[model samples]
Target: CLTASSNTDGATVVVEPCTTNNAAQTWVQNGQTLLVFGNKCLDVTNGVTNTNGVKMQIWTCTPGQGDAAQHWSITSTKTIQWAGQTECLDLSGGRLTSGNQIQVWLCENGNANQVWNLV
Candidate 1:
Protein backbone atom coordinates (compact mmCIF):
# COMPACT_ATOMS: atom_id res chain seq x y z
CA CYS A 1 0.00 0.00 0.00
CA LEU A 2 1.21 3.54 -0.69
CA THR A 3 0.54 5.31 2.58
CA ALA A 4 0.79 8.90 3.72
CA SER A 5 2.46 9.46 7.06
CA SER A 6 -0.31 11.86 7.90
CA ASN A 7 -3.27 13.56 6.30
CA THR A 8 -1.33 16.68 5.49
CA ASP A 9 0.93 18.23 2.94
CA GLY A 10 4.54 17.08 2.84
CA ALA A 11 3.79 13.71 4.39
CA THR A 12 6.18 10.88 3.73
CA VAL A 13 4.89 8.23 1.41
CA VAL A 14 5.69 4.71 2.51
CA VAL A 15 4.74 1.17 1.69
CA GLU A 16 2.61 -0.62 4.22
CA PRO A 17 0.45 -3.69 4.14
CA CYS A 18 -3.00 -2.87 2.80
CA THR A 19 -5.53 -2.80 5.60
CA THR A 20 -9.28 -2.51 5.72
CA ASN A 21 -10.75 0.90 6.47
CA ASN A 22 -7.35 2.55 6.61
CA ALA A 23 -7.65 6.03 5.16
CA ALA A 24 -3.93 6.56 4.93
CA GLN A 25 -3.61 3.61 2.59
CA THR A 26 -6.26 4.82 0.26
CA TRP A 27 -4.96 6.58 -2.83
CA VAL A 28 -6.85 8.07 -5.70
CA GLN A 29 -5.29 8.33 -9.13
CA ASN A 30 -6.28 11.67 -10.56
CA GLY A 31 -5.02 11.80 -14.13
CA GLN A 32 -1.28 11.06 -13.92
CA THR A 33 -0.90 11.79 -10.22
CA LEU A 34 -1.75 9.81 -7.13
CA LEU A 35 -3.68 11.65 -4.47
CA VAL A 36 -4.02 10.98 -0.78
CA PHE A 37 -5.88 12.76 2.01
CA GLY A 38 -8.17 14.10 -0.69
CA ASN A 39 -5.94 16.94 -1.91
CA LYS A 40 -2.33 15.86 -1.64
CA CYS A 41 -0.57 14.50 -4.68
CA LEU A 42 2.27 12.00 -4.60
CA ASP A 43 5.36 14.02 -5.40
CA VAL A 44 9.03 13.48 -5.95
CA THR A 45 11.11 15.45 -3.51
CA ASN A 46 13.15 18.14 -5.25
CA GLY A 47 12.07 16.50 -8.46
CA VAL A 48 13.77 19.04 -10.69
CA THR A 49 17.10 17.56 -9.70
CA ASN A 50 16.08 14.12 -10.89
CA THR A 51 18.67 12.77 -8.50
CA ASN A 52 18.75 9.14 -7.56
CA GLY A 53 17.26 8.02 -4.23
CA VAL A 54 15.09 11.07 -3.64
CA LYS A 55 12.22 10.10 -1.38
CA MET A 56 8.57 10.33 -2.33
CA GLN A 57 6.03 12.41 -0.47
CA ILE A 58 2.57 13.88 -0.59
CA TRP A 59 2.23 17.53 -1.44
CA THR A 60 -0.54 19.89 -2.35
CA CYS A 61 -2.07 18.80 -5.60
CA THR A 62 -1.01 20.92 -8.56
CA PRO A 63 -3.38 19.64 -11.13
CA GLY A 64 -2.72 20.72 -14.72
CA GLN A 65 0.17 22.82 -13.59
CA GLY A 66 2.76 20.87 -15.57
CA ASP A 67 4.67 20.01 -12.43
CA ALA A 68 6.69 17.06 -13.62
CA ALA A 69 7.51 16.09 -10.07
CA GLN A 70 3.88 15.35 -9.39
CA HIS A 71 3.15 13.63 -12.68
CA TRP A 72 3.38 9.86 -12.67
CA SER A 73 2.30 7.00 -14.83
CA ILE A 74 2.49 3.23 -14.64
CA THR A 75 4.24 1.94 -17.70
CA SER A 76 3.49 -1.17 -19.69
CA THR A 77 6.34 -2.88 -17.85
CA LYS A 78 4.66 -2.19 -14.51
CA THR A 79 7.06 0.49 -13.40
CA ILE A 80 5.93 3.90 -12.25
CA GLN A 81 7.76 6.71 -13.96
CA TRP A 82 7.58 10.43 -13.58
CA ALA A 83 6.76 12.65 -16.53
CA GLY A 84 9.65 13.32 -18.87
CA GLN A 85 12.12 11.78 -16.47
CA THR A 86 14.15 8.59 -16.60
CA GLU A 87 13.72 7.79 -12.94
CA CYS A 88 11.13 5.36 -11.65
CA LEU A 89 9.67 4.75 -8.26
CA ASP A 90 12.04 2.41 -6.43
CA LEU A 91 12.00 0.41 -3.26
CA SER A 92 14.73 1.83 -1.11
CA GLY A 93 17.56 -0.76 -0.86
CA GLY A 94 15.19 -3.23 -2.48
CA ARG A 95 13.75 -4.21 0.89
CA LEU A 96 10.28 -5.71 0.97
CA THR A 97 9.49 -4.95 4.59
CA SER A 98 6.60 -2.75 5.57
CA GLY A 99 7.19 0.94 6.24
CA ASN A 100 9.82 1.04 3.51
CA GLN A 101 9.87 4.47 1.96
CA ILE A 102 9.75 4.68 -1.82
CA GLN A 103 12.30 6.58 -3.82
CA VAL A 104 13.02 7.64 -7.39
CA TRP A 105 16.04 6.21 -9.17
CA LEU A 106 17.22 5.56 -12.68
CA CYS A 107 14.94 3.20 -14.50
CA GLU A 108 16.51 -0.18 -15.08
CA ASN A 109 15.22 -3.07 -17.09
CA GLY A 110 14.19 -6.08 -15.02
CA ASN A 111 14.72 -4.22 -11.77
CA ALA A 112 12.25 -5.65 -9.31
CA ASN A 113 12.52 -2.61 -7.09
CA GLN A 114 10.89 -0.47 -9.75
CA VAL A 115 8.01 -2.76 -10.50
CA TRP A 116 4.51 -2.26 -9.13
CA ASN A 117 1.17 -3.98 -9.55
CA LEU A 118 -2.15 -2.26 -9.06
CA VAL A 119 -4.33 -4.32 -6.77
Candidate 2:
Protein backbone atom coordinates (compact mmCIF):
# COMPACT_ATOMS: atom_id res chain seq x y z
CA CYS A 1 0.00 0.00 0.00
CA LEU A 2 1.06 3.60 -0.64
CA THR A 3 0.22 6.62 1.47
CA ALA A 4 0.73 10.28 2.24
CA SER A 5 0.55 10.36 6.00
CA SER A 6 -0.53 14.00 6.17
CA ASN A 7 -2.42 13.79 2.91
CA THR A 8 -0.11 16.54 1.65
CA ASP A 9 2.99 17.23 -0.37
CA GLY A 10 6.45 15.82 0.33
CA ALA A 11 4.90 12.84 2.04
CA THR A 12 6.76 9.61 1.43
CA VAL A 13 5.06 7.07 -0.79
CA VAL A 14 4.74 4.41 1.84
CA VAL A 15 4.96 0.71 1.00
CA GLU A 16 3.02 -1.68 3.14
CA PRO A 17 0.66 -4.56 2.92
CA CYS A 18 -2.61 -3.44 1.38
CA THR A 19 -5.46 -2.89 3.75
CA THR A 20 -9.17 -2.22 3.32
CA ASN A 21 -10.49 1.30 2.71
CA ASN A 22 -7.46 3.20 3.94
CA ALA A 23 -7.80 6.78 2.75
CA ALA A 24 -4.05 7.28 2.53
CA GLN A 25 -3.68 4.23 0.35
CA THR A 26 -6.23 5.44 -2.12
CA TRP A 27 -5.00 6.21 -5.62
CA VAL A 28 -6.80 7.57 -8.65
CA GLN A 29 -5.31 7.15 -12.09
CA ASN A 30 -5.60 10.00 -14.55
CA GLY A 31 -4.01 8.84 -17.75
CA GLN A 32 -0.52 7.74 -16.73
CA THR A 33 -0.36 9.56 -13.42
CA LEU A 34 -1.43 8.24 -10.06
CA LEU A 35 -2.95 10.78 -7.70
CA VAL A 36 -2.87 9.97 -4.07
CA PHE A 37 -4.13 11.47 -0.80
CA GLY A 38 -5.94 14.19 -2.72
CA ASN A 39 -3.93 16.76 -4.75
CA LYS A 40 -0.50 15.19 -4.79
CA CYS A 41 0.63 12.92 -7.58
CA LEU A 42 3.03 10.11 -6.91
CA ASP A 43 6.48 11.42 -7.80
CA VAL A 44 10.20 11.07 -7.41
CA THR A 45 12.12 13.47 -5.27
CA ASN A 46 13.99 16.23 -7.17
CA GLY A 47 12.46 14.78 -10.33
CA VAL A 48 15.52 12.56 -10.77
CA THR A 49 17.18 9.47 -9.41
CA ASN A 50 20.84 10.01 -8.60
CA THR A 51 21.20 6.58 -7.07
CA ASN A 52 19.32 3.78 -5.40
CA GLY A 53 17.26 3.95 -2.20
CA VAL A 54 15.40 7.07 -3.24
CA LYS A 55 11.96 6.13 -2.07
CA MET A 56 8.85 7.24 -3.95
CA GLN A 57 6.90 10.28 -2.76
CA ILE A 58 3.94 12.44 -3.70
CA TRP A 59 3.83 16.02 -4.87
CA THR A 60 1.35 18.55 -6.22
CA CYS A 61 0.53 17.76 -9.83
CA THR A 62 1.50 20.28 -12.42
CA PRO A 63 -1.16 20.54 -15.08
CA GLY A 64 1.48 20.68 -17.80
CA GLN A 65 4.76 19.90 -16.12
CA GLY A 66 5.75 17.60 -18.95
CA ASP A 67 8.34 16.23 -16.56
CA ALA A 68 9.14 12.55 -16.80
CA ALA A 69 9.64 12.03 -13.08
CA GLN A 70 6.14 13.16 -12.30
CA HIS A 71 4.50 11.01 -14.89
CA TRP A 72 4.09 7.24 -15.14
CA SER A 73 2.86 4.53 -17.46
CA ILE A 74 2.30 0.83 -17.00
CA THR A 75 2.78 -2.03 -19.42
CA SER A 76 0.41 -4.96 -19.76
CA THR A 77 3.36 -7.10 -18.69
CA LYS A 78 3.11 -5.36 -15.27
CA THR A 79 5.97 -2.91 -15.51
CA ILE A 80 5.42 0.68 -14.41
CA GLN A 81 7.16 3.19 -16.62
CA TRP A 82 8.72 6.31 -15.24
CA ALA A 83 7.15 8.76 -17.64
CA GLY A 84 9.17 9.11 -20.84
CA GLN A 85 12.37 8.03 -19.15
CA THR A 86 13.87 4.58 -19.38
CA GLU A 87 13.93 4.07 -15.63
CA CYS A 88 11.40 2.02 -13.68
CA LEU A 89 10.20 1.36 -10.16
CA ASP A 90 12.32 -1.42 -8.67
CA LEU A 91 12.70 -3.35 -5.49
CA SER A 92 15.82 -2.43 -3.59
CA GLY A 93 18.53 -5.12 -3.80
CA GLY A 94 16.25 -7.15 -6.07
CA ARG A 95 14.59 -8.45 -2.93
CA LEU A 96 12.50 -7.29 -0.01
CA THR A 97 14.37 -5.89 2.95
CA SER A 98 12.98 -4.22 6.03
CA GLY A 99 12.83 -0.45 5.46
CA ASN A 100 13.49 -0.86 1.76
CA GLN A 101 12.76 2.16 -0.38
CA ILE A 102 11.28 1.75 -3.86
CA GLN A 103 13.49 3.37 -6.46
CA VAL A 104 13.78 4.18 -10.17
CA TRP A 105 16.44 2.49 -12.23
CA LEU A 106 17.09 1.36 -15.76
CA CYS A 107 14.67 -1.39 -16.64
CA GLU A 108 16.13 -4.86 -16.96
CA ASN A 109 13.97 -7.13 -19.02
CA GLY A 110 12.42 -9.98 -17.04
CA ASN A 111 13.97 -8.86 -13.76
CA ALA A 112 11.66 -9.71 -10.92
CA ASN A 113 12.61 -6.50 -9.15
CA GLN A 114 10.86 -4.34 -11.72
CA VAL A 115 7.67 -6.32 -12.02
CA TRP A 116 4.41 -5.60 -10.23
CA ASN A 117 1.01 -7.26 -10.16
CA LEU A 118 -2.50 -6.13 -9.29
CA VAL A 119 -4.01 -7.76 -6.29
lDDT of 1: 0.84
Candidate 2 lDDT over residue span 10-92, tens digit each: 77764566679877778877777877765678788888655555677778887865356678888877887787777887776
Q: Which 10-residue window of candidate 1 scores lowest in summed lDDT? A: 60-69
Q: Model 1 off-target regions past 4 Å? A: 63-66
Clashing residue pairs found in predicted model 2: none
Count of clashing residue pairs in every prediction: 0, 0
Q: Candidate 1 residues 1-119, lDDT tens each?
A: 77788877778888888888788887777888887777888899877555899999888988574377899888999999987889998999988788899899999999999998876
How many clashes show up in model 2? 0
Q: Per-residue lDDT for 112 in model 1?
A: 92
Q: Which regions of candidate 2 deviate over 4 angstroms? A: 49-53, 64-66, 95-99
* lDDT for predicted candidate 2 compared with the true structure: 0.72
